[model samples]
Target: MKTVKTHITQLLHAMNMGIFEKEHPIALSLLSAISGESIFFLGPPGVAKSLIARRLKLAFDQSTAFEYLMSRFSTPDEIFGPVSISKLKDEDKYERIIEGYLPSATIVFLDEIWKAGPSIQNSLLTVINEKVYRNGQYTIQLPLKGLIAASNELPAQGEGLEALWDRFLIRYFIGNIEQEFAFDQMIASVNDMEAEIPTGLSITEKQYIDWRTQISQIKIHYTVFELIHSIKRQIEKYNIQKEEVPHSTLYISDRRWKKIVSLLRTSAFLNETDTIRFSDCTLLLHCLWNEIEQIPIIEQMVSSALDECISHYLCGERTLEQKLSSIREDMKSEHSLRETKDPALQIVDTFYHQIERYPVAGNLLIFASDYQSLQKDTQKLFYVQRDKYRPVNWILKVYDHVRNRNISQSAIVSLKKGTRSVFINNQEYPLACNAGYDIAYPQEASLLFEFRFQEVIDLYHNRESE
Candidate 1:
């Protein structure tokens, strides 16, 4: 399993070479291909939508690809292939040649797919859903690994397009490069846009077949099932809230949910995990939204759910509240856990630790809440100066060694519990105990409690970083 994961991960990395801002789409498309599902790309022209499909073909060894631009005037013969006149005339039977068309290809890409004629659309429904093509008298099973469709505009409503639209399990929106540096590199590069995947890394037909069997064996954890149900309820609530706008309502079928779970399972299998994790739920952002406007909303919902789930899981069998309660119980049991009553200066009614090594006018003060926030990322904190042993109104400036300037009033800071250091503007300073400060600096029991509380934070960070 580890070797398979390494191969797939390296293959995906190789496939993403020379591309800009299309990594997510390319990864999802490759995943869909391996899962035996189809994906739809919605974006304007020249956003590398077709290029993604082309690159996907390179992932498979000896795989053939068929690409065509569809229009209302297109007929089945252009897409499915021309009919064999000899068979029609000699035997009075009908069947397509099926030799260089979509049915015979390993990967297929259709551009402007919404404009395809009804005849082509009707045939495509069966091809995408069942992986079989009916060419009059014969139903040939297609060798299709994945079918990728792209369009600048969505299908017209009430035009019998709903059924076909529902067939795509993954719908993604691609846009131009947003980063200035990447965009500059994109326009100035002389390298070929089509990346040449390493031949040794290309997936073989037998390996592909075996992967499908192994993918099904991957387990879906109960937390994943619970998250799905929670997301469904959130969707229902959203529909109720937006009942006035019929188009705003999100309608997902049971079949689509089943397919989504299969995709999650495949992701877990490829990532070398035995069960689905909270990180896999992030993929739902692409699968659940029906309209472009709903994308951000769905993303926020999924992100919030993931955060709560991570917090719960990291705290172990007990909830965060329970864990904190146990910690407080331990604190109460220890008689030496007492606050110092020395006359130390304070700011904003909060006790602060003074810094003499760094040139700062004020005593550095960090609220407990703000200190906890540093476990995730760096934060900017306000420091105030004292006047005649009293808190002053004006915020004091602090020297930022990283930027080589004095940042007015606030310092970018992070906490390093292992070293007992506080990073100010990326410069580390040892946090030493002052003689007369409250909450005895770096008490063994207090540090032990803090470590127990935050040991799982690294797990959450590692998963997200991956």
Candidate 2:
């Protein structure tokens, strides 16, 4: 498995030799080819979209490639093959030559694919999805490892092109090189744009066939399955948010998802992993988006969902926020009982917790408007001391109805040893964690959670570094 991965990695590097900013498309195209799935490239001209497909062909040994620029005038004969006039005259049967056209080729590149005529598009649907071509009464199993299609524009709506568009499992957008140095190198160098894959590195027919079976057996981690479901839920939420807009919903069919999982499994198999890693889920950024605008949204959603699912998987089902809330609820119950037993202890008309140990001579209180914020943000605040007769410079900034102005209240607050404590006027007072609230429930769980959380986090970091 390691040797196979090393060979494929070397092959990918060799294929990307002179190409600038096209490594992703080339890699994805090759992966699609080995998985027996088709990819669609959506980009303008001169971005090397066709070159990506051409380079992918070099990855396969003894592979025939068919390249064509489709137009509305294109007929089935030009795409599939010229009809067998001899067969029609001699045997009174209709059949294509099926010699050097798409059916016989191992790799097919069709540019401006949406412009192809209905006859050509109809035949391509079968060829791409089923890898079978019907020439008269015979069904010819295509030698197609991958069909790469490109177009400057998306297919027009209501044109009966939806089926063909859906046939492409992996859709990617290509663009010109952005970095100045790479662009300079691209123009100054006289190296051939075509990649020269090493003969030993190129995949043979026997290897390709064997890989298909191996790829199917690659394990999909439970986390990856949960991540996919999380992404689907995110897409559903996005669609609901954009419900008013026409055709704004992002939809993935069951079949497309199956192909997507297969592509991920194939990626894992090639990378020498027995199970799909979280990194494999990153590929979904390219596979999920339908419109160009949805790319960034889809990327963000996948990234966020992947991180969230990883955290949940490693640190148990409850999140940090939920754990903290549970602690707060328990504390609130205790506070309510304390107030009920002694009404004099209840600080009415004020939201602050009286702190008795401020080293100064004035009464001090810590603002307790929100318990979580008091615990989380108080330590980061700066404090000032003043004379007993003067108001402290630091103000809590609350409206004073009697004076018709805002006023200040002095307080010293800090979070220490998993407890929130405050000092006012030389006396100590504890707030939420006084009764071992933090230590008893959430803190212990959080300590255990953080250890496992960091392990998974480091795993992702190491994978990225590799």
Candidate 3:
């Protein structure tokens, strides 16, 4: 078993190296191949979707395995075999069956699969689902252990072929790589020019048969049984759209999902684990996430289902949610001060206008002293420049306030004129508005009034909460 697993892993590495990058899809294909079952990869052109399938057949080096790139011109005879000519001549039913294209091959790659006409596809349904073909009066069981089909187009609506889509238990989507890989991909392609296929690393026929036998014997967990039910429930809750209700849903058919878990267990057994562990669920999630619906739903399922298990394996604790909440709370508080500082700003405006109209009026500083005193002080009557343009920053600084907690009340002081600088909460604030050091240092007057207003509001809110 260890030697077989090692050989399979090595074959996977060779198959993966054939593609320039796309390591994730290559890994998925390797897992799908481990089941020794048919897989259909649905992706756009030029993504090396078909190449992965071809590589699998090459890995086995089975000469009897046949591959066909299906086209509009392909007929039923092209796939299942022509009506047996001997029976037609003799009017004997048995000799009339001639094995078609698909039935004759042990491993097949059906390219552009959907383009095959309805009748041809109808013929494939039994061949794929049951591994048997019917022609005339004969039903021929095939040696077909794996069939990897590729299609550029997705399964269509009302095409009346749900059965066909469901047979392809493992479906993969291949997308373009990011911009950073652009130049690296170019260099890799140039180097791969005229690359020859290497041989030696492979899965033997006996090993393949044994793996398939093991796949059948693998016992599924009851928790996984319930988990699959929950998955179906979630899918229904979201009203997810699909080409069909996959056969796995209705037919009690086991999925590549189940097979993947089996393989992970097999891998662990080879590594000498007496019981299959939660880490196997990690690979199960990876395989299922790709084959399932859109990305958001897939991510939510994986995170909710297996994140805890994976975290325990990697870190031994459940801190993902706690860390996220801490970061979120910090962000919310940083921005909450913006919500509270609106009122402080209105008082600042009133002070500016008061300074402009009345300059030093005795107790009012320059309005009382006279026009001469105002002119002597500065050209602008009462300009007050704040050091910080952000009103919330100034409010927080002056109040000496920390979020979610209160500070002791400081006695409110009236704004007083001073040519020397004034300090609020020990930070020197230079006044530069028209009320600069003239009309009671208008900024200080504004802040003191605003502080009293906020104190009253905060008291009411805190009291209400209590």
Candidate 4:
């Protein structure tokens, strides 16, 4: 297992070395291939989309590859090879040679595939979905390991291309390299600097067969299952909301989602692990989104899902933090305070609703109830100088609810014993309630708020029902 993982990982590394800024497309292409799935690249012309697809065959080491550029007029005969004249005339049955077409190839790339007319598109749907192609009298089992498809634009509504579009499991949007990578690549091009293309590391046909069979037996970590369900629920909630995102309803077919487990197993296999890592869920960013705009939304969601897991912790998510910080700045401004309106009320309410709307388990709820409480008090203060909204002790209560929703069972046990924390990479991490600063920091009553956490916990249990 380790040997297989090492070879595959090295092959991925080699593929990445050539592409200037396409780490994700290269990785997903490799993973989709290993899992016997198809991936589609959505981007404009001349973005190395075709280049990445062409270079993928190197990972399989001299595997037979078929590449084609499809157009609006491209025919099935062009892709599947010509029909055998002898079979039609002699046997009176229809059949194509399919010798050098998709069925015989291990790795395939179809550029501008969205341009393919209905005949080719319909034929491809079956070939990609089931690895089987129909030819008049018989269904031929395809040797197709993986396919990488590209389009300058997505499918239009009148084309009847929805079924074929949904068949590609991983929809990745690619573009020109970022400024940093662009400069580097330009320098390399001028100097003719190139990395040696090594091709020895590989997953052979026999190894692929054996490993794929073994992958079915790999136990899925419960966290991975939980993540998948959470994502589905999140998408459901998003679609139901009032916001109008273009093509808001994402339709992942039953077949595609079922096969996702195999993709997860393949991801775990590459890491040489029996259990799926929280990091493995990152690929969901690529797998779930069918639209170009949904990329950012999915990226944040996948990151948030992984963050709250037992294995990973989010220090802060950048974009939301910046938004929060901006809101904070405006709320505290002197000019804003002098006004009759309570700006904090609206801001805090928005944050409160957002927290409830997309509540991620295990993430330290960045906007606390205290923040909400402060805003409430601020509202009272503005009404009259005598009005006060001093926040009292709610730390223990907040901690309890947070721990229930957030902490793993094992870590909760550590908290009960007052283990304080276990160190990771030189930082002391609290097993349960975040110690000192988180509980203590700058509250209206700091000292009292800091202590009595254990007492509160103890008295609540012992005095009533310990």
Choose 1 or 4, whichever is better by TM-score.
1
TM-score for each predicted model, relative to the true structure: 0.67, 0.68, 0.55, 0.64
For model 2, name the residue pairs that clash.
355-424, 356-424, 356-427, 357-424, 357-426, 357-427, 358-423, 358-424, 358-425, 358-426
Q: Of the candidates numbered 1 and 4, which has the greater lDDT value?
A: 1
lDDT of 1 at 360: 56
lDDT score, residue 130, model 3? 74
| Reference-based lDDT, residue 396, model 3 | 20
Q: Rate the local accuracy (lDDT) of all candidates.
A: 0.74, 0.72, 0.51, 0.63
C-alpha-based local distance difference test score of model 4: 0.63
Query: Distance from true position, residue 157, model 2, in Å?
Result: 1.7
Q: Between candidates 1 and 2, which one is better according to lDDT?
A: 1
lDDT of each residue in 200-239, candidate 4, tens digit only: 5666778888888877777766567657766776777777
lDDT digits (tens) for residues 1-466 of candidate 1: 4398899888989899999888899999999999999999999999999889989999999999999999889999999999999999999989889899999999999999999988889999999989999988989999999999999987777799988998899999998899999999999998766687876899999999999999989887766765786688788899999999857788999989999998898888888898887877777888887778888999987887677566545644454457567667868866525432223323244423333355554444443223333432544543433433455322222223422223443434334322334565566654434446543344322234444355334323323321
**Cα-lDDT of candidate 2:** 0.72
What stretches of model 3 exceed 4 Å from their correct place?
Answer: 61-63, 94-100, 177-200, 240-277, 282-293, 308-466
User: In candidate 2, residue 211 scores what lDDT?
Assistant: 91
RMSD of each: 17.2, 16.0, 21.9, 16.4
